[model samples]
Target chain A: MRFVLVAGTTETAHIEGISAAGADPALMAHTPSADLEIVEYGQPVQAPVMPVSPTGCPTPAVITRAVHELTEFEILALDAGLVRPTSAPTVALEAMPGRDIRHPRPVDSAADTFEAARQLGRSLPDDELVIGETIPGGTTTALGVLTALGERAVVSSSLPENPLALKREVVDEALAASNLSAGETADEPVKTVRHVGDPVLAAVAGMTIGATTTDTSVTLAGGTQLVAAAALARHAGVDTALSVATTSFIADDETVRMNELANDLSLDVTVTDPGFHHRNHSAMNPYIAGEAKEGVGMGGALALADRAGISMADVREQVVAVYDRLVVDESL
Target chain B: MRFVLVAGTTETAHIEGISAAGADPALMAHTPSADLEIVEYGQPVQAPVMPVSPTGCPTPAVITRAVHELTEFEILALDAGLVRPTSAPTVALEAMPGRDIRHPRPVDSAADTFEAARQLGRSLPDDELVIGETIPGGTTTALGVLTALGERAVVSSSLPENPLALKREVVDEALAASNLSAGETADEPVKTVRHVGDPVLAAVAGMTIGATTTDTSVTLAGGTQLVAAAALARHAGVDTALSVATTSFIADDETVRMNELANDLSLDVTVTDPGFHHRNHSAMNPYIAGEAKEGVGMGGALALADRAGISMADVREQVVAVYDRLVVDESL
Candidate 1:
């Protein structure tokens, strides 16, 4: 199975308290770009920039890297939309960076981006694809897309507190701005994403649609953002063997209860824990404390590692090694 | 096997009589870009622009698309450097378009582009790759690269006449401008490319290095440009299973005598004849007459189709169909 990382940025990430993708909200725009670099190269090429939450939790790319080292899975990164350029080589679709969801049109050129990604999906050599995404404030935009498609989704957040009310308010205002009500866009998937979703949603959903039309099976990998993609794909009439994979942190979150969302979308879901809660590493403590639940294909990577017969202890060790090498060593 | 088209451009192609890729020298810069779009979509997304020779020979991408249809081989496009934006989605490497070979540094960021492509090559899912290229005036640049690496190479030309004297003069002027002599750069492959080669050479050579390090085997698919890449990779100490695949037109070019170059590089070579010389169609005449002889993975695509039990007649039929659909229909 091939692991493809679909990364993008949204203007919604600039809003204070809306995203926990980086330590400083002003620097969140660089989070997805940095995350892709870290996954591809074990560190960012740009000096002294790494994706971290305010609570000191590292980006989920570390987990993905560990899994890659363990299983040797090949990776390909796709740029849905990027505010800043990444050091990693990416298949560019010339997609525009998403606007704030409160804007009537959050994602310009959604249809074009979708069609391009669909063409890409149809040409991929791999028959099985696990598509992961990295975007700050992606869950809030996930909420936006889910609501616009008329789903009552309690999306998971990277933050510990979940910020349900804040997400709800943002989605409500976004729908009102687009002159759309819940369920109004059920039949118009691309239009719904353009109105309220982010570029990653459109790209991931489009790839899934195209891949599934062939012999390829897709595993949408992330938290609620990927859940939103699954919902969008299903609403867009993609019928195939599709599954959602997320970290146990998201599955067990009190506010998320992701299984219900998966069930609502008629999708199968897989949750992976990597045994971080029981580890003694201080760097992993924030994960147990629920700061960075899931964002960058951690769950899908873990599942691949598991299928390869790699132990969670080994994955934790590699994660710690990567953290120390990329994060701790860089700070020093 | 996966087929990847690595495309780029050079200011060298803008030089008079150096390139025959497009109907006008002024328009040659768009030839690679439009070639990629045609290979991906069977037509350029932008109407009224298709890659063709000044003599009305269609781009070799038609042959590549025909092979893709006959064998369902997965295809990917990589942008080594492009003078113009293409309608097809591409894996962007941020490589700079090459300057005239006479410039001291023809390709900026050669090492960086190489490293990036190397990383991408290491991550590709396929076990075998057929890498091709599309660039106007590529043979002249290939002559420049081959000579810098100390090879007594005679590169093929897209034009009916090989233009050997013109290519040698350009290479000599380029070497003089760089204040280097032939064979002086034998030990510094990346530096050699930066001094006189174009972006596609560096990108293709790097990918060959990276892919050959793993279980992946590579076929450098084209005429002498790919032979130059093979030479670059070898001088850079890439010791692995690598071969050059090209059309019979290149193999039969009296000026090129490609077998000698392959023997000097110690690389195995495969030559594919698509039987265009015996075809009845008017469009086949240009190819038989040795204009637009070989490019855009035509050689490797034909090899793959032949292995897949596809007949040359079927391949020719698809090529004509794509030509009519994309070129003939659009013009009318």
Candidate 2:
């Protein structure tokens, strides 16, 4: 039941103008401290409610942290294209800082990054590993990577109401900007990632390939972002053992159609139910309403916690305590 | 039987002078590319020999690389306190580069690096791990650490003749400069490293503490440097499951009482013989001559490779081939 959590980021999240993700701009602003919190506390508690979406919703990193408390999950922060240094020890994939995905080539170093990631993959044992990510504007880039990989996916967002129009607008602009067409990825998977995907996805693809080659089971954590990464790994022909693990929040979101995305790529999916509605934390209420559903690996963390024998109630109570510590009595 | 090799360097290695080690000055300069060689050829073949010492002798890294090709053990490069960027994926402990041991403090970031290493240890599954390092002037620091921990043991060298006088001179200067006394490690293990040890040794100590915390069997690879780290970890009471693994070239050398050093620490030692003399590679003749004694992950890599059933002949041929490719036929 033990696992390693590879956390990473992409600058493209901040470039897409805040609304692309459900995490609150305030929380997003505090994203720099996420690794610090993880290093200091068993869970992330960077004051003012951790990394919540714009709607006061929490980031999945909190869930990942809480799961660590329950299961002592091994966590490794992977610096794929981050804007800052992580407070925690990090396995640097040494990716070039991501370019604006809006320009049709968000990650020019995709090939080099992939090579490094694949080499990294070649080194890790195939023990079951769950790789997760936290990129603010990741979904838009996911849409880009997916689109380039010949799939038109309906991506979910952090905003509960699902900023579909805004996402669609960006998608349109990104498509027009990149001049990429659907069904054109048969021979250009790496190129597609270079043009539209972020560094995290590319590293994930490379890690998945590397992990699977040694018979290690892999679970891609997060929602649409991982769904897209799964497709790339599969396209690279090393993803038969890959599974996408997310939360019911993302699974039930009509906007993301997460299940459909998984099916599109013939991947297995695991959706953990945190039962936030049964909890006492109002900070979590937005989740039931579908706002800021999933991002920072909450889905995978919850699933892993459950696998380690933690109950949904335990997860809810612990998460509420974290919310209270981080959100309540802001003056403290 | 698969494991990850966390390799990195510390500026301390270079500070001890080119004569402090047996690695050729030319080959030693390319240490940063050793991981690249591991990634490309499954052993180190860094365009030039990765780590020959001042005496024109081969190092344990060369042997480690040859062993890796036969064993195919999983590897991960961990950057403890390196002077340059490694040309491969690395788990950066992000330690401050080392200062000269001639000053009171050699590594200022020992505690911080140790904390990071412990976190790294917490994150890797208690699965078996072989942690190795390559700090150019590490022996002097090892002397500092060992001395600080109350052990006035003799230190080994990359030089066949063992530059004991020069090393003792430096150690005496470092101890006097730091105003540190023997057995002062109750509150100064980390500081001892800071004042006289290198980041690689500190990281090795930290990583050993962290790795052993999770019940994972750990093998500290190399000669005196690792011996010092083992002492610090033991002094801290976190090295119960730790073992020191090294090469016979280092062990058989009359210069380094490596066995007695291990015995003093009450730690188990496993010395793997690569049987290089039976082979035709003149490049390896230096090892039998007792030059470039050990560094990189060679000691541990050799042990693990043997465990994986690789014959000494297999290791020799592979090493010779690498030497031929990277050293002998320079035109090609």
Candidate 3:
């Protein structure tokens, strides 16, 4: 098994109150780079800022890192687009950071990045690939992609209150700007991402589609954002078996229809609960409050840990240790 | 098993008569990029030019491509430094091309690239890694690194006639410009590469050292240039077992001390013969004449093919087919 974390950025994340994946809207651009760096190096080496929710919850990379330390699975970082540089080694696909979602062509490198990632998918030397993503405001972009593909997608938000109206308005305006109707781009998956989606969606979709050509079984590791990738792959004419690994938060989100989306795409969905409420860590309180649901493959990591016979208590302990070491100690 | 081909370049290759990996001195800058592109995509997508020796001898990438078509091993291209861009997907390490060896600091990104490659090495999923390199004028840089490390090194050349005196003169001048004596930078292997060696050497050495921390065994796949990487790893105090894979042409070259260098570094060496002389094709005549003996992981690819029960005749037939499809036919 191999863990591939695809990191990218979108200026749509800059929209105020649209994303909670970073401490501030200005920090959203840096979140993807920081998340992957923290996963690889235990801390961010490129910047002083760590990826945290608006309510001060640590990014799910803490959970991913804990699982990696326990299972010792090979991890690879792929740079679809990054607003900031990371000191951790990454496979750069030379993609440009996405513009605001209202821009007709937000991800100018969509086709190229997809082709590049598809080539990468074909060459991964593993039977199983768990692909995760870290892109602030990605759920909104996921809604845009799913809507463009003719799905009435209700995406999960990192915030306690899902910003359904705000995401739908943004997608509507984006579609109007691109002169696209629902299902207009169903036949052109790459063009769909280029019009209204971020670079990470195109990359993840391309990787999944490419992996289907081989013996590798792909696990899309995220929330509604990865569901958008599954839709993109499905529209691209790939019928290979794929599964979705996501947090119970996403599976249980009243605003999102994860099961319906997975069923529509013929994807088996696995939801993992990390039992964070039982842990008395202040840093994990936001997760308990549903302020930050899932990103950075938290659910997939937890499932791997479970399969490796590591208890949730052990994972939670390691997560706290990582948080203390990387977040608390580093701040000092 | 996975094959990683590290591609880089140096301004030293621009020096006339310094390298024969390309058709002309100017073309040398594109050889590394083009070679890997051919190996991955069966042809160069970046430019119309294909890598060929001054005598129109095709690059060894054709052989690697042929073997890859036969035995489907995951092949990855890592960009250490590329003067020309390749359309093929590659893991970009953001390394700068090495300056002329006459400069005191030839490869400025040596330390950073080495560290990045080291991280990548530690995360590779495969238990066995075959690391090859395609860098024009790399043998001369290898000699520079070898001399700086106090080794009485004899390096191989792509040209039939070994340019020993010219390579020595360049290395000697490089040492003089750096104001360093033999073995002065032995304790600082990264510094040794920074002063005189190319980025590919540092990348290969760093990857080898990093892989030593795991169960993966690394095979340095090339000739004298790889020997330089072995020596770099050795001087860096890495005691883990490593091996060298090269062609019979390099092993038989009287001007190169392949066995001596491997023995000194305690690295097991494997030499493969593709039996190009037995083929009747005009392109195969170059091998018969000992021009462009080995490169682009041809030796390692051949060894893998042999292990898979593939005969040399089958490999030669595929080579001709690839040449006809990619080189001969594409040119027309």
The stretch of ten residues in a row with the least summed lDDT in candidate 3 chain B is B85-94
lDDT score, residue A326, model 2?
Answer: 56
lDDT of each: 0.85, 0.67, 0.85
Fnat per candidate, as a fraction, reads 0.10, 0.10, 0.05
Q: What class would a CAPRI assessor give candidate 1's docking?
A: incorrect
DockQ: which candidate is best? 1
Error of 3 at B252 (Å): 1.3
Candidate number with the higher TM-score (1 or 2): 1
Interface RMSD, in order shown:
7.4, 7.7, 7.8
Off by over 4 Å in 2: A1-12, A15-49, A321-332, B1-78, B83-136, B142-163, B169-332
lDDT at position B134, candidate 3: 93
Which regions of candidate 1 are displaced past 4 Å? B1-7, B10-78, B83-137, B142-163, B169-197, B201-332
What are the chain A TM-scores for all the models, listed individually?
0.98, 0.89, 0.98
